[model samples]
Target: MTATDNSTVRDADALRADMVRALHDQDAITSEPVAAAFAVVPRHRFAPEAPLDLAYDLHSTVPVKKDENGLNLSVMSAAHLQAVMLEQADIKPGMKVLEIGSGGYNAALIQELVGNDGVVTTVDIDRDVVDRARRCLDDAGYGQVKTVLADAEAGVPDDAPYDRIIVTAAAWDIPPSWIKELTGNGRLVVPLTVRGTTRSIAFDRDGEGLISRSYRLARFVPMQGEGAAKERKALLRDGVVVQTDDERVPLNTKALNQALDTPRREFWSGAAYDLPDELELYLTLHLSSAARLHASKEIVDSGFVETSALLGVPALVSEDSIAYRTRRENEDTGGFESGVVAHGPQAEALADEYLKLLRRWAENHRCRGAATIRFLPGPAPSTLPENSVLKRHGIVAVSWH
Candidate 1:
């Protein structure tokens, strides 16, 4: 090869090595197989339009496609997240794998894990994405990874009984077909959206339902086609909004906005706050009336809302009152202390309810992976279980042990 070509190859190899090391340090790459896959995959080839540095960045996603309104339709997920999910999958050599969302780089990594004897099939609802992934896989010498253009909601039935199925997009629920298509002992790793928050959960088959082995905080583009989320969003003002998938949660936009006009009330839980992901999972599930509260930087800067709302925090909403979690550094605790901010006439009641949950979590389930999630597919029961979220296809029941 020419000197210029040799230099480019060396640069890509260096970046890949750095990314693997960072992922390992963060505990995202916990297995040798996963580390090897990340080290070998030429991630930059999948997103040729992006800079090489961006392709190898550990925390940033490379956008692949956008919609008419300039929203990302698909993106190459960050390397750290990919490594986390792969480790969660625990794919072994000669294992047949099905990827719900098509991204050439991830599929290539899967190919490396599965080896020559294994089969890899990737499906995407968008034809453009399928075409792009197909070309990228071929260019990267991963043509053995099959590409299919179809809505992943139905799954690729022709290749049923996959040992492992990894979904890249944010799924609202686990469909019946996915469970049926997997082998009896297979594992399905999906970024499932429960209420308004999403978590990447690793589930193993259990009878007609699925049970989680582990879950971690994750964010991804929403799934398209038949299984799209049915969540509702009400814009309270220019850059403030509340979103919820639960039908029981009230979305009184006018009343909520008016409640914001009143003075804000703050309630301190007097409990140590850490392990935010675990805390959030408990709060979102246990809150009687829950939704996600979001505010823009402009509103936060104006002192109308705290920075917690900037990224959408779990909120307790009543007819005319709202309360959400906030944090303050506690010198004694050596970290942060959880608190509540409420508004409207029933602010006291809402804040009391929210504060109770915060303190309960801190007292009982403050550690990571304390909650176990189970997806029971079929018709909903007359009385929904406590800490359960209903979906079109199943009920997501979460319990702390």
Candidate 2:
């Protein structure tokens, strides 16, 4: 059957159950409230145009809105990642919640979890998204929730003292105003970029100080409108494509595009793992740091293919890994190194560290277990590294200036 035809048969309840199962598999649906919220919200309604195969995928991203350039501007987010955010927030009923990016799907889910006693106010910079979200909510019988088409950076101050605030986009830094608007004991969950890695973190305001509990590696479309981020420089290397725009950071698919043509056999044929894969892996890990250290990747073709061949590339890290494609031109040898391009030392370092961490994390945890990665703002330590463990509850702490 066609995608829309399939959507007709699979109702929201069934889809929600499947989503719950997916979250459970990822260890994200730990709370009964979060599970019920996922069960009650109809995700398909929010992303009607998604492919049929993706309708039931637990960790797939469903595009909700795309920009003029065909870039996804907003999305429903991956099911597992959403669950991770909820779990991290420790959402409860009767809590006033502020959602920076609003749509019927996410607001409805939050409203269901917060229950009738609680209040949910969603804000979006784009009036179109706001109006569309309103229509969707009304259609879904969620008229009680409030939606505003204004800058999220200023925040919904009139309704200040929110018990919980969730920002569903990648933010360069948490606005001080958001913290001030939060309740004395409020929780502000945001996807924060540290160095170059984006991880969702739930920061709780305790008295005058703020503390974070959970962290999960995540990738989200950049937050736009009022507090939009400044553009970042693109990394340029031989045999790769780079694209940039005025508002957002430059696209960094040079390495990914290069991976498509590079034969996997270049790295894997002689060794147990693929060389191109290893190089790619190194790039991913180091990119996080490179984004922090040097806003760009500068690779000099060092012909270190043999060194890369020795180290087996670690398996993919997260669900988003599926979104990437590594292809080959000829069938004779695995096209591990044809399409892929190595940007710079940072990319290579990221790939190398990713391999090491994958092995270490797997050995220690056995299962990823819906683990969260969080970055917390902390004062640089006198003796320890800037991000040293200021406080550790159940998540890792990476300090951001």
Candidate 3:
């Protein structure tokens, strides 16, 4: 219990070292301190039930707990994402860090970054997760790390003024408490979901508002409790789905489903298709009515939908029609060119709208991290700014250069 079970000790060490090397190779671990922390955390110990290969897998998450519906309630986030966030945090020795979700492995890594003088606390709303994390932390020689069983929405008041607050879950909005709890210059790295896409954004306080320093494409389990997302979902038959958080976007499942029966229309933007993440953010924010279209492989294979929706693609949705991004390799461009696929009675109108956005992104803001995301905490203004999403706590405003 003191170190990894001796039986797997050698294997775990070698796996851990290999994992660190792979993180560096992938550019997930940039600084020496984060690399050192990953090098020693004994990740396999936290997920003892998982296979060593899976536990140390760089891009895979080791599931910790799931609900009766088979949805993940908690997971050991992918090591690659963890490293990226830690680097974004830039944790210094003797700095205090509060991890919003409890997972022994991440807390252990944070402990290493903070060193002897720094304090680390992990909180979870579920008692079972807290108890399990406490047990794992103790077994892994991270007893110094504190485990609290409480809803993380309130930001662990007893340990006020954290140097860094890192949320492992995907949040719909930045609560006022999280910003209030940060030290004057403290940073918060959270996976914030906007429109329908989620990005891990590093936010620093700018007066009473929060401005993003950087944002990376990330996927994580949605937060539970007070900060849970209030998304509207529509099932347009067996394998096709559409969802959005913007209350203004209409989701008429029956009408949209019928639109699928109409002949499909395709339009090319004449713009190069690359840096999909950046393009997606721009489209999601700039679209007048944005939603996400998702399709199972079966649907895509049946020639009913494009492969872009297999994971989820930004869609411009109207009352009875939908237009989502698609791409095809073009010899002239030397790569893929952005295009649109529209369905329903308004297919032409929707496709024209979608194509314009695609061309605009390629011409003006088609680069990594081109969008500037800002969160202003307070009541909504009488007239909200353009490209602004309203949340319970604040309005998220995004702009492009």
Top candidate, metric lDDT: 1
The sequence of per-residue lDDT tens digits that candidate 1 reaches over residues 1-401 is 99988987899999999999999999999999999999888999998999889999999999989999999999999998999999999999999999999989999999999999999999999999999999999999999999999998888999899999999999998888899999999999999998788899999998999999999999999999999999888899888999998898999999999999899999999998888888888899899999999999999999899899998999999989899999999988589999999999999999999999999899988877898999999998898999888889879998888
**Model 2: residue 288 alpha-carbon error in angstroms:** 14
Candidate 2 CA-lDDT value: 0.59
lDDT against the true structure, each candidate = 0.93, 0.59, 0.92
Per-residue CA lDDT of candidate 2, range 137-253, in tens? 887789999999888877888788899999998876666678788888889899865434466878777555466666566788888865565545433335222322222222445
Q: Single out the weakest 10-residue window by summed lDDT for candidate 3.
A: 1-10
Residue range 45-126, candidate 3, lDDT tens digits: 8998899999999989988889999999999899999999999998999999999988889999999999999999998988
Over 4 Å off, model 1: 1-3
Models ranked on lDDT: 1, 3, 2
Instruction: Return the lDDT, model 3, position 233.
Output: 97
In lDDT terms, how accurate is model 1? 0.93
* Predicted structure 2, TM vs. truth: 0.64
Q: 2 or 3: which has the higher TM-score?
A: 3
